[model samples]
Target: MTWMVTGGAGYIGSHVVRAFGQVGIPAVVLDDLSSGHREFVPEEVPFVQGSILDTDLVTAALREHGVTGVVHLAGFKYAGVSVQRPLHTYEQNVTGTAHLLEAMQSAGVTRMVFSSSAAVYGTPDVDLVTEDTATAPESPYGESKLIGEWLLRDQARATELHHTSLRYFNVVGSGTPELADTSPHNLFPLVLDALAEGRTPRINGDDYATPDGTCVRDYVHVADLATSHVAAARALSEGRELQRVYNLGSGDGVSVREIMTAMAQGTGIAFEPEVAPRRPGDPDRIVASGEAAARDLDWVMRHTLTEMVTSAWQARQAR
Candidate 1:
């Protein structure tokens, strides 16, 4: 059965698409190209150039492709930018999800895998965040993603829908050199971009409560994340019951300073990162336990932190 991957032309989306193909599943790409590159999508795979906000186009694509399920990843993903542009974030993530669900119902597509975010946990007051962590998102982007999950939950109760939402932390690295994270807001690109340009990479702040006095976050490789997405899709397609939500994390916390250190080793660029004032809404630390995901979704951290940086650097250099 064919599956439609919304935002499949973007970084993480493109990796998920390739993972599905490797598993012998046919996938079609539907991306607006807002933050996605046209070349990121494989030429062999079918591509629909449109937004999930366009219900009619999505419905037509689903019906035409005979798509039996959907991997929903399209949304406004920048947490910091969402603070200043909440309305735009809502329209893109919340409204876009509703519209996608509407189209799925119209086309009788009953299976879905939603790409959620760790931001939904806000500042988790725990050593390790879990699926049961109380959701109290701080930014509009996080709020929008939580709303997206709710929309799917609400819709599933009323219709023939089998769905799962994956709430993951910072996603970095690349599955292939051809598919790089092009998000200007993402950390891997920002640090690598600065280094490539002979500019000093800047760490947001160095006054946090972490051991290194910088924010500690969970960063997972993109390829591992993509494999898990496909696993979730397969579970849904096979009529296996999955948790409503899962946390795909490393169960480890890494500070910004540590990331910078890894950046230097990975790129062979020896320079101290400049420290800047902490951005608003940044938490001191947030890591997650992937126990549940590991048991169910075949989740595993196959790539080390150094591998993450080096792979990301390789992709950046390829671009």
Candidate 2:
């Protein structure tokens, strides 16, 4: 059966698309290539150059592919940047979601795995977050994603659709060499770029209450994340009771200093970072418990933090 992968040309989206292809599940990619690179998509995947907000284009693609399901991944995802452009964020994340759902229903696609985020939990009072955690998203980006979940629920109530919104935290690492994040947002790749240019990677804050006095967050490999997408798709295809939401994470927190040290060890480079003021809306800690996903989807993340960082560095060196 063919599936439609919105944003199938971006870093995480491209990985998910490749996973589907590797499993012999045919996929059609709809990407505007705004932030997504054309080179990231696999050559054999059918590519549609368009936006999800384009209702007619999306509907046509869905019908053309005979889409059995969708894995929604397209959105503007920079938390800090969302604060600068809240309206743009909402239009892309929320309005675009509504457009996609309408198109999906029109095309007879009934299942999807949404790429939600742990950011929806905002700064949870507890250090570790679960699916049941209260959501009080501080940034428009997080709020938009939470609203997307609401949109999903609303659609399910009115249609035959079932969805699994996977709330993940700090997606990192690289599996395919060609699919590495060439963008400059993520921590690991940004640091690698700085060190490669003989500049120091900046540390945002050093006085947090964590073990190393830096903000802590969970990091999961992109490959493991892609694996969960396949699992979610299979579960829905089998007509199993769909899990409305699941957290995909390592359930362990890694600190900024710890990550820097890991990078130093992995790349054989030692340099002090320039300590700077914390970026606005930066959470002190965020670690998600993936127990529910493991129980329901039988998912396991085999990549270690060191391995994730080293693999990213390898991809960086290749670039």
Candidate 3:
């Protein structure tokens, strides 16, 4: 069965598309290329250029590609920018998800795998976040993602929809050097870009409650994340019941300072990161246990931190 990947031209989405191909699954890509690079999507894949907000376009693409399932990854993904542009965030994420669901129903696509965010947890009081953790989204982007999950749940309850949402933070690394994270907002790209430009990488915040006085975040390899997406799709296609939500995160987290150290070591760039004010809506630490995902999907940390940095650096230099 052919699976359609929304935002497949994006860094993470491109890897997901390739993962599907690795398993011999026919895949189609739907992307607006607003932030995604057309080159990120392979030449062999069917590429549909459009926004998910366009219900007609999405429906047409789904039908044209004979798509039986979708790995939905399209949305306004910048959490910091979403704080400033809440309306735009809601329009693209909340409204856009609604439109996508409508299109899926119209095209008779019953399976969906939503790529969600750990931001839905906001600043959890606990050390480790789980599926049972309370969702208290602080930013508009996070709120929109939570709403997207809700939309899936409500639709599944009312229709023949079978879906699951995978929440993750800081997806880094590369399946191939050709596919790189081009986002200016993500930490990896920001640091890599600064170093590539021969400038000092800036740490957004210091003096946090953490031991290193820097924001701590959970990070996973992009390829590993993509593998779980495929696993989720396979489970859904096989009519296997899956949890409503799963956190694809490492139980242990690394501080920004620690990440900078790793970057220096991995890239062989010895320079201290400049201290900068924290971005709005950023939490001090966000780590989660991926036990559920590991139990259901074939989730695992296949790459070490060094590997993550070197792969990202290689890809960044390629771009």
Candidate 4:
């Protein structure tokens, strides 16, 4: 089966593309090069330069390639920026997804693996979030993703398209030898950039309710997350029931300070973080339980925090 990976040139998307290719799964990539790098996609795969928002381009590609499954990973994903530009975020994350869904339906593509986010759950009062938790997104980016899942739900009810929306939390780490993070907004890359310049990485807050007085989050390796997509596709192909949503995470919370310490240790870089006040809409803690994914998708996280930092640092150095 030929799989079409949207945003296949991005950090996590590129890893998914590589993962599918490594397994000898016939895959093609469609990216607009907005946040994705063309060089990230392998030369072996058929790469199409286009946006999911473009219905004509998307439909044509799906039909031409006879794509049976889609792994949707293209979207705007910055919490802070989403607050500043709600319309732009919604247009890219929601409208873009709607367009992709329509194109899929038109082209008779029946299965999909959407790249959802844990931000959809917002700041849950509970520490370990499950798929059953209430979704109360605090940022527009999160809200947009929530809407993306809603689109899938509505579409599945109306058609034969089966989708698995995997809500991801803090997707990090590297997969390929060239694992440079092109997104300038992510925490890992931001911290790495600061350290590379011998500058202090600024911590938004260090007086939260969590240990070390910092907010905590679950950081998962990109490769492991990509593997979950493959499993999701397999389960969908096995005639698995209707639309499903699962949380893919490490099942452990790591504080901001802890991550910084780990990075310093991993890269042998001694740099302090400049603590600042908490940013707006910032959650004190967000960690996901991968029980649903583990049980349903048979997923497991293989990398530790040290491994995440070390791999990311090495990737940054190579770039």
Candidate 5:
């Protein structure tokens, strides 16, 4: 079945599109290119360059592509930045999602897989986050995602729509050298950029209560994440039952210091990272259990920390 992938020209979205292609599914892309690169989209896929905020454009794209389903990934994604740009975040995420859902209804498309974030948990006190974990989002970005899920749920009750949201932690690495995480705020890009520019990467606060006294976070390879998205879409298309949400996370976590070491090893930049004060609101550790996702969405952490770093570094260098 053909599907429409919002933000399909983006790093993560492009990988998801590629995964769909590998599984012999035709996919169309809708992206405004606000943060995505047009080059990331494959030549064979139909690309509609427009924002999801435009109901007419979204509806036309869905109709034109004969879209049977959607993978919603377009939105304002930076958590820290969303705090300062709350209105912009809501407009892009919350409002945009509403518009897309409306367009889907207009086009008679009833299946979707929403690309959500782990930020919805907002520094959970638990060592392993489960699907039942309390959602206390601390940022507008996270709040908007939760609200998007709510919108989907409310719409599902009123219509024929079937959907699932995939919440993921730190997404790193590359499925191919042609595509890389280019976000200035992401750890992999920031560290790779620093090393490429001959600057030492700095660790924020090495005095936490965790092992190595540094913050630990769940990191998953982007390819694995993309595969799960495809699985979720397929499940919905096949009328398989799915929970409202699933966390795509590594059962264990990797510390920031371990990341620094991996970066050095991967890039062969042997300089030690400088220690810096912790950023405000930074949690010491946050990890999630992917048992639910693993069972339903084909979730798995297929890459090691070293492999993640190496793949990311190689992609950055290629870029």
Candidate 6:
């Protein structure tokens, strides 16, 4: 079955597209290239350069590609920036998702795997967030994702759409040296970029109650994340039952200090990180249990922290 991968030219989307190719699944790419690089898309895949906001363009792409399923990944993704650009975030994520769903309906495409975020949970008080965790999104980016899920649910109730949203946190690492995380806001990229520029990476805060006094978060490799997306899409295509959402997370988390040590070891940049004040609203820790996803979506953290840093650093240097 052929699938349409929105934002397929992006770092994470490109990895997902590559995973699909490796598994012998036919796929086409639809991306506006606002944040994605055209070069990230493979030469052999059909590429449609357009925004998901355009229902006509989306519908046409789905029809033209004979897309049986869609993996929605295109959206305004920066949580910190989303706070400053709430309207832009909603327009791109919430409205864009609605338009894509509408286009899917028009094109008779009924299966989808939405690339959601753990930001939907905000700063959960729970030690290990489960699928049943309350969704109290703090940023517009998170809120938009939650709304997108709601739109999919409502549409599913009214139509033949079968879908699942994968909520994940701090995705890192590279599946291939050619495909790397380029997000400026992500921890790995930020640190790697700083080191490449001969600047010391700074820790946001080191006064939290955690072991190292820095924040703790679940970090998953991008390739493992991509495989789970493929599994989710395949499940939907094969009429397998799936929950409305699943958390792609590591039950045990690594602290920001641990990441800093790993980065220094992986990059051989033995400089001490500058300690800075905590960014407002920063939680002490946020980790989720991937039990649901592991059971249904083939979720797994296949890369160690050192491997994540090394692969990411190597990719950044290559770029």
lDDT of each model, Cα atoms only? Answer: 0.94, 0.89, 0.94, 0.88, 0.95, 0.94
User: To one decimal, what is the Cα RMSD in angstroms of model 6 from the true structure?
Assistant: 0.6
Q: What is candidate 6's lDDT per residue for 1-319, written digit by digit as tens?
A: 8999999999899999999999999999999999999999999999999999999999998998899999999999999999999999999999999999999999999999999999999999999999999999999999999999999999999999999999999889998898878887988998898999999999999999899999999999999999999999999999999999999999999999999999989999898999999999999999999999999988888898888889998899899
Candidate 3 lowest-lDDT run of ten: 276-285
Instruction: Kindly list the per-residue Cα lDDT of model 5 for residues 176-269, writing each as its tens digit.
Output: 9999999979999999999999998999999998989999999999999999999999999989999999999898999999999989899888
Per residue, candidate 3 scores C-alpha lDDT tens digits across 162-260 of 999999999999989999888878889989998888999988889888998998889999999999999999999999999999999999999999999
**How far is 200's C-alpha from truth in model 2 (Å)?**
0.6
Q: Model 4: per-residue lDDT, tens digit, 94-136?
A: 9999999999999999999999999889889987898889999
**How close is every model to the real structure, measured as TM-score?**
0.99, 0.98, 0.98, 0.97, 0.99, 0.99
TM-score between candidate 6 and the true structure? 0.99
Better of 3 and 5 by TM-score: 5
Clashing pairs in 4: none
How many clashing residue pairs appear in each of the predictions shown?
0, 0, 0, 0, 0, 0
- For model 4, give the RMSD to the true fold: 1.2
Q: In candidate 4, where is summed lDDT lowest over 10 consecutive residues?
A: 234-243
Candidate 5 stretches greater than 4 Å from native: none
What is the clash tally of candidate 6? 0
Candidate 3 achieves a global lDDT of 0.94
Prediction 2 TM-score vs. true: 0.98
Give the number of colliding residue pairs in candidate 2: 0
Please give the lDDT score for candidate 1.
0.94
What's the distance in Å from true for residue 278, model 1? Answer: 1.6
> 275 in model 5: Cα distance from truth in Å?
0.9
| Top lDDT prediction, candidate number | 5
Q: How big is the positional error of residue 195 in model 4, measured in Å on the Cα after superposition?
A: 1.2
Regions more than 4 Å wrong, model 6 = none
Sum up the clashes in candidate 1: 0
What's the lDDT of the predicted structure labeled candidate 2? 0.89
Name the regions of candidate 1 deviating beyond 4 angstroms.
Answer: none
